[model samples]
Target: MDKIQNQVRPVFPFTAIVGQEEMKLALILNVIDPKIGGVMIMGDRGTGKSTTIRAIADLLPEIEVVADDLFNSHISDYDLMSDFVKNQLENNANLTTSLIKVPMVDLPLGATEDRLCGTIDIEKALNEGVKSFDPGLLAKANRGILYVDEVNLLDDHLVDILLDSAASGWNTVEREGISIRHPSRFVLVGSGNPEEGELRPQLLDRFGMHAEIRTVRDASLRVQIVEQRTKFDQDPNSCIKEFCEQQNLLKQTIINAQSLLKSITIDYSLKVKISQICGILNVDGLRGDIVTNRAAKAFAAYQNKKEVDVDDVKEVITLCLRHRLRKDPLDTIDSGTKVSQVVDDILS
Candidate 1:
């Protein structure tokens, strides 16, 4: 395990990324306010969608987690722990803190049900006549990120499991006379090529925002991207050394932004605007309004604004509300196009 950890390469730097500003902004917004659920990036292959997400993971500031815990429980926020941990604390057990790597757990497409939710240790059960529950990817992802590539292609059963866990912030398993439930609260990020398969509407609604990415078309930008990648591949050590300083600076910026998010307020006018947008778009349920409001506020916070304004709301509307919009049967209008129209009308 130590050797494997040592061999793992660092993710690309988020600040050095080019193009896909909308996708980048939406992701940053979610990081600022995880209550906004998480952003889904859907687009063509080779559009840097996955690359951008992995890069952001590297730029994120480290978090303090409970030592020896399967779930990366935040040391500062003990209130968010499961009942089991709460009970342990109530019994006056020593709770240790350790600075751990902030998680960015990737869910592979070929993952099995056992790998997703975990299963009982049959060997231990048979030998010691005891039931022991092993933690899975979801457990390790707690208080951090759970990234799924080719999300739309994930098995139907796995999708259901993820949806339920994400909504409740817990994963419960019951089988073979053993029942276990653990905290699984993590930012759920998914990326996929929309052209290959469309995500189920139910799952789509769970995401707070969605961004579409496309390959950079500008000749110079494309050349720069290729040149940088080639240079990095040729000399990873020097390339990473050169970029590490900027990556560290960006990590600090994210930490500052997180602290700033708490002070940023949302104006009543902007709240009304968010509600109005949801009403005009005919989006179902109150989640749309809530997510849009939160995302706009986070965007403002990221910009160092004290309060959310019309521009902030407008800028983030396409990202927040796009996935929630109803598809038109007669019209093939893209979500972005519809959102732009609404923003223009509201601002005008």
Candidate 2:
């Protein structure tokens, strides 16, 4: 068993987070539409970046997965399973599912490729003449969250591997005398303080949305945050209980949005505006349009609307465009500001 699997603790409630509304919204959008990719959080240390990301785990509703499958493969993913597994699933009308926590995997900076992508079980191969695989962090994170703290400082090779796996939604480990491929889909959340170092442009481009946060400067707000933290530490069970009702409501909201997302629609005019805004900003590719479209649909669903609106577009513009904007020598404004300006020009 993985060490992380062994070390379990209660996560703080998402409702307990004091501020950073944008961060919270962005995370919810991703849950509604994983196709928006994942969010990159660049901020000051002790700003609750990690805490907010971790709290997301508990708010998520439990997933129904294969009872005996370590990969947590959903029943609908039978086509992606191995031949034997597919046959087993097909033959068994008695297929069982167990509700498990939505996995929240922490990818430490010093992790190795084999550790990320699993390794062949050498003991089984040598002693029993049977080939077996030991799953890794990426496998554990399948269909869930893969969170990297201090992502900017991660090794280049590891970053590249992460980028590839994140892009393809699958991982293949061919070394250690065994080859294995599995569904490794996950929402890739990364956070780092910009003062430490800048993220590689390649990896930066891989993220679907970007949010920059700072420590709360308001005296009263800071005091509120401290009190919340103190309460959580003193009696976590009570603290979690206090927020349980809200968490349950939020969880149901997310679940409803997931099912409603497919039915949400946008008019051609709004779609054109999405394209034009990205064009005016000179974003590198169609990724901006796709992310914006998906985000808007998610926002609409979250709001219990069947069709997207201009407000939906406005709500997610900064997050979708900030990281994808191209730099110009003459433009000195912040990326978020630039996005806001273009959105205002087009949608106003």
Candidate 3:
């Protein structure tokens, strides 16, 4: 069993996850529309945050790419390729193409700036007296998920790099007298325990949705959590098999949702509703309103609806605006609750 475990590691299915519905929903929303921005899953330790992310990685479909491309550059992005590749394509060279699983690149706590944004390959330079842009984690994560555990502990410099890349949808690195740029668009997913530290306000605002999770409280529910975890550990294949139907259903739902989002109607009143809620909450800037609008549409699409409704707008207010709320010393109410209250006043 130990050897078997070592050879084929198994992940707990996303559908089998017992609780944290909001966390799961937040992640799913991103899948439907990555432009809704990334997700920040913050909570106490051992809350299965990372496990949920891994399960999502398992559920996502593979993507087509140019074979042997370090950046996983799509054919549509051929213009961004190096001069060599541009010339080859111009000459009708035989460039291989293939399908690969959507990458889930982990950004470790100790990752350096070079590791994140990339630098010239040091090993090749020393061994062969050659220089090449060894694409970094950001490059690998392009058009995929970028999972950052302990995101609060990320170095300040790396945070800046991520912010810049995420904002511009590209990363340019200059090293060894060579400059290279590539598409670095990705859905950023981060999880961290608040006991360690709070993330910077700037970075927090960057996440499209913020979900604060807690341990299962009800005794029976807690028991199920433990039981399912044990069963999964002992027989992951069997556990996953049991959930296969629901898993496949959810996978298809998201794929359909992606198509549905493009056609989902965004009414003018819906825009007013979003603006009113944001205005009532005193949320800074326009990000809260924008994220809420996108999230609401994504939610409608997820539910197989063709148009955005008031209820749909109501459902996502807290997740979209919670982290954007300015600190209020006088008001003791929860920020999530505040968003709910303001939403009621404006939309009701």
Candidate 4:
């Protein structure tokens, strides 16, 4: 039998995207520090939530991964596959490393539970009388990004599966006398129109940050967006060529930011401020505090700063903890308004 060919898919350019700076920043922060967990973008439809995520493919730094691994396992000290792969390597075993662009797999709304979790290859097993594990989206998304559109409308079962995988950084499956476990760590990026439905609280809590985006109301910006999009649709090759230089520069900036992220430090004062903000907001768990601190650090790193400052903390607090705040019956305060109030109180 002939081997099947895999085709490369095109992704939108990050530099070409028009607006929604907050969403772009949140996604960039997560990439700089995956320990920030993930980001959720909830807003009106057609506001470029999905486009912004797809654009991420252009900005990611290339990663060195173990060749032929189901999870695109990283060859690093902190890698989840370090134990297994290291043992194999120490036994005079040979391992190949491949330079691959980071993955950004989309989980469609209609995806089945099994498809998301992976399942047995019954056909392959029956014909060959051998057990074969058919990898799923989660497996392919390892060490990359997993984007879900209309996430609020995804089935409850799928949401549960995602939460479990996101929490453990691994996906485990058992059935038909087969048990399999694989590293499934991926930065989760979920976008949805909040008006359509509410995301389950369990799933919502898994997100490290949340950004709300709306359509560009500025007439000039809107016009420019439309014109640029029309031009790209009409002549994709030339249109992309026109922006390729800028996009490449932006990609390098991301690579530089990632390199700097490791050296960025968080100040004790800023840590207290982050804690105070979360405490004032009455956020329920320690996750909020951890994410806010990490995001602030990443934001500073992105700005090429060596230390986190109050401004960086203020800028990322809303994205990190807005969705985790306690609501007051009489306040009727939106997350944005509440965040602003907190910043004002802190800065004052």
RMSD of each: 2.4, 3.0, 3.1, 3.5
Kindly give the number of clashing pairs for every candidate.
0, 0, 0, 0
Model 2 segments beyond 4 Å from truth?
1-8, 79-84, 90-94, 121-131, 176-178, 328-331
Candidate 1 per-residue lDDT over residues 301-333, each given as its tens digit = 777788888888888888888888887788778
Query: Could you tell which candidate, 3 or 4, scores higher by lDDT?
Result: 3
Give each model's whole-structure lDDT.
0.81, 0.86, 0.86, 0.81
Q: Give me the overall lDDT of model 4.
A: 0.81
Minimum summed lDDT over a 10-residue window in model 1 is located at 1-10
**Could you tell me which residue pairs clash in candidate 3?**
none
TM-score of 1: 0.92
* Candidate 3 lDDT score at position 108: 90
Better structure of 1 and 4 per TM-score: 1
Question: How would you encode candidate 4's per-residue C-alpha lDDT over 29-103 as one tens digit per residue?
Answer: 888887788889999878878778877865676788988777787766455673457667778678898988788
Off by over 4 Å in 1: 1-8, 82-84, 121-131
Model 3's number of clashes is 0
Give TM per candidate.
0.92, 0.92, 0.92, 0.89
